[model samples]
Target chain A: MTESTLETSGRDGLDEQAGGQRNSAAPPRSSRGHRFTSYDVEAFEVPGGREEDWRFTPMKRLRGLHDGSASATGSLRVEVDGSSAAKVETVGRDDERLGTGGAPADRVAAQSWNSFTEATVVTIPKETRAADPVTVTVHGPGRDSTAYGHLQVRAEPMSEATVVLDYRGSGVIGDNVEMIAEESARLSVITIHDFEGDATQVSSEHAHLGKDAVFRHFAVTLGGDLVRVNTKVTFADRGGDAEILGVYFTDGGQHQEHRLLMDHAQPNCRSNVTYKGALQGDSARSVWIGDVLIQAAAEGTDTFELNRNLVLTEGARADSVPNLEIETGEIAGAGHASAIGRFDDEQLFYLQARGIPYDQARRLVVRGFFGEILQKITIDEVRERLEAAIDEELAAVGV
Target chain B: MATLEIKDLHAEVETEEGSKEILTGVNLTVSSGETHAFMGPNGSGKSTLAYAIAGHPKYNVTSGSVLLDGEEVLEMSVDERARAGLFLAMQYPVEVPGVSMSNFLRSAATATRGEAPQIRHWVKEVKQAMGNLEIDESFSERSVNEGFSGGEKKRHEILQLDLLDPKFAILDETDSGLDVDALRVVSDGINRYRESGDKGVLLITHYTRILKHIKPDYVHVFVGGQVVESGGPELADELEESGYVRFANKKEATVQS
Candidate 1:
């Protein structure tokens, strides 16, 4: 509360920082190669942590995911459960649906594509509604080895379902996930990065929304040594709606980053993005990047993105950058907001003055900070479990 | 049954210009069943005294002693002071987002009462308290003081004063910004708490209008960060006619001479 937090940074002041490239069209001083994306690993060179997208990431901590040295010596275990209406298939690289959603944009993402052995595809049949949510759990190979994996969640036309992709346990890994929502389909993809031990992961998830399709994505990252996720979304036709919500807590010596891009390629489409994170203990760091591109053809696009971060301790830091690019002034609206606030001393003081102890006061403030997004999870089990996880984090720090 | 003492209290606040002394040396005593009105002009350190006693960090106690029942309150933390029966209904009640009023009241009640109030009885107690203050039942579901109007905030403060039932309540300008109807309701709440006979009350205000509704046993004319005169109810009547001009002029004259 002693300092003024940057609320929005706004579209006019995008070049002031490392991540503030307002328009990816000209991109201030970003590399021209940033716009190139491909399925081939050779398309992306080894990042030296200076590119606009890789600047915030610690390249050394990527643990060879950026290079081709991260060899897969150990096997990755995948578990699929729930949703009897959904069909699960382990398809080889030759499967036609393997790369239908989108391609890789970063070096690590391209490496994951070139290395993974098989892909898990969960498809909800056309015009069918799922009774239970599908849970896909991926456990990494421990320290002595690295694991590469792929997952694709496909929702057929007029179908409705929820998919939970959970990443847990040890080791280093790079992976790709694609979520394709067909015409008029309603799909929600929730990814939880709850890695244990010294796990390092680079995940890129591509989501494609067809005409009139509705897609909702959630990224809940809690435990990790170094976890970075890239979420790219594209709308193929009009009336498609997409929402991406992310919640993360970074502990001591931990780094968690979520990079988001929403591509409004079709007219009359809509998208909303929100992310909240809290960092505590020494050297705890977090990064949130929201890049929204509204093409000229998407004349009626309506979108807003917001990212908020709370730093709970002295050595903890949070970086929030929201970039908005609008090619057409005819669009309905395009807006982005970012805020990085330290533990509000006034908020803590207010609660403590009411006879609540210091620890309880801190917990209350943290809960309130994340309450708005957690309330939107819609899935009861996920919401409750995340609440417990937050409490456990507070207890770990003796808040 | 209880005594609240503030002896030779000096407090300062940090600002851009550096630490500025607010409360020069404040001495006052209020015992059970007694109401003392500390009347002063703006910037005379009236609210500063309230915050200093409540242990707000912004108001640093440079040199002072605040004792409740012979326990040094200055040595206690903010919440500890509340547990020791020293309550301050802040002039601007803070907005605690995501914390429901019911939850906050229960947590504070538990801390002060040394245990959780029985849920069944606690609901009834809170409902009755809110009803007595004319607050809507839905207020319990909302965040504490968030989006509350000026009148609503004051009423909520009195509601806490009633539910918490602290032995000594220091109300800092509780009557400010309240409409006529809200002032009546808030005064009634304070009056009910005072009628308990075992509680001590320190009412801080700039105007005498509130005195018409809730009479104080002692009225202290405050100026120059300390009380200049102490008298009975008739002193309020005198101030009502003369205002604080004479008291302020006397201080200016004393300072120059």
Candidate 2:
């Protein structure tokens, strides 16, 4: 395997941790006034496109979308317990230093990731298990602006909590989240990205799983101009398990993409990933890329990934790519399957023959597609939110 | 006035090996207020006959006709056929997840009635029908056929029969997987569906246990994909007593012709 590397932009003066070869223009001196020290930034620096794992994603899309690159800090807020938890925070003191904050107003004018707001980090106390789900709401500032926020999570050993993040309002936004699952800890995360028709969204997730830990991630992308989720999970010890699930619906010029990577680095680890989405209207596109890897050192690993997409309309399109990489001579079980097909005409006809209208029959088909993901949610409130998100997406598409 | 008539019915299905024949030159008729039984072993074209009548695309009618109350239903789509008063209780009811039984029934009734029924009235009727089948009230809230046992699936099929209220229905071996208690519940549901006197039924099965409850007026022996013998209900008794070997031999001779 090729060595992973991370680079920093010298002129930008943003905190960057380089993994392999340092860039020639790299800045050595660090600032003390900032909450994040050089060591903190280094720990957060993700492997860029130089690594094989990040090759599928077009780096050009992230060229300017980093946390501190945007000019405007658009109106973004997270509400918990009937009050705003925090305002949208950025990495720079002025707009000139952060470039155009998030996305520009016009589609033609927006270039690369410059439309994203700065990354806002939200920290949850270790071992603090809350009774209610935390709600993070993102409201757009409208016009030409993009917002990016990274809610850093660390659930201490034996702690359990559920986080609900809602992306409402208008405009363009780019968000990313990095979650750390401590030893024997559990975390349930629900994220609903409901962008308006004209807005664009690009988000990423990097999670680390400790020994004997459990992590459940459910992402629902119901609305967006361009939505892409890049998520990666690595099991650090045996007996760790992760469930990565999502439900997405798009129609008419909307682009939704989910790229998932699950690395089983320890023996006796388990990972299950299932994502289902539906596409409607001409020119609508949905993409799913599932990469499951079992290293040679990790014997006795059981991993399975399935991505199924339903094309509700003739002109709508969906692409599913399921990749499996096994580097061991050991006979461990690992498999992947991907299917992209139109609605089952037989099923639709069967429902219709029972006196269901054509339109209602279509709804049932879509419902079945998303039901696979919705059934995994254990909390009632989260499930209801997912249902409402789906309903709103369907209504927006005139279904 | 609700009557089902199959006139010299012939149907063929296209397989990869080319077109094959399933239903070959069969004829039958069932008027309103009558129950007919079609008994045959597996692959005897019983289910094919039912699917052909319901307008399944796989079944091609080469040179026969199906008429319901003098209206030719062979040209209609499956949904159109259902709206025109023809229903088929599948041998294996499909499991459709995320679609509640109540929602499916209401939507089906709306399509057939040309207008959505009042929610209260529809719920009352569905509840009453489900009650007659020994189904709990919670059954309506579940996804259609999903996680339902074989017996529960069969009962749900009967619930559709009662709720859709089709003029003529083809019950395709609905009693095959039911126990004694479930068999009684299913038969009772079917009986209630026909109490209005405007419904006709063609119950197909391999066993005669279902006949004990539905009490068929006529029984036909299906062998070699054709009805080899037709008689009163006593024919079912004869088959139950002697088995289908004799009928199979007779069908082989007919094929040699």
Q: Top DockQ: which candidate number?
A: 1
> What C-alpha lDDT, on a 0 to 100 scale, does residue A145 get in candidate 2?
66
A225-331 per-residue lDDT for model 1 (tens digits): 99999998988889999999999999988999898889887999999999999898887888888888776678899999998888887788788878776666778
TM-score of chain A of 2: 0.74
lDDT string, candidate 1, B1-257, tens digits? 89998898988999999999988778899998999999988989999998899888899998978889899999998888887888888888888877888888898888888899999999999999999999999999998889999999899988888878899999999999999999999999999999866889999999999999998999998898778788999999989999998798665565579
Interface Cα RMSD in Å, per prediction: 1.2, 1.8
Q: What DockQ does each listed candidate score?
A: 0.69, 0.39
Candidate 1 collision pairs: none
Candidates in order: C-alpha RMSD to true structure: 3.7, 9.5
Q: What tier of docking accuracy does candidate 1 attain?
A: medium
| Tens digits of per-residue lDDT for model 2, B1-257 | 77788887888999999999988888899998988999998788999999899877788988788889888989887888999888899888877767787778888888988889898888788888888888999987888888999999898888888888899989999999899999999998898877866779999999988888999888999876678899999999998998887887877788788
Q: lDDT by residue for model 2 over A234-267, one digit each (tens)?
A: 6878878888888888686777878787867688
Model 1 chain A, TM-score vs. native: 0.93
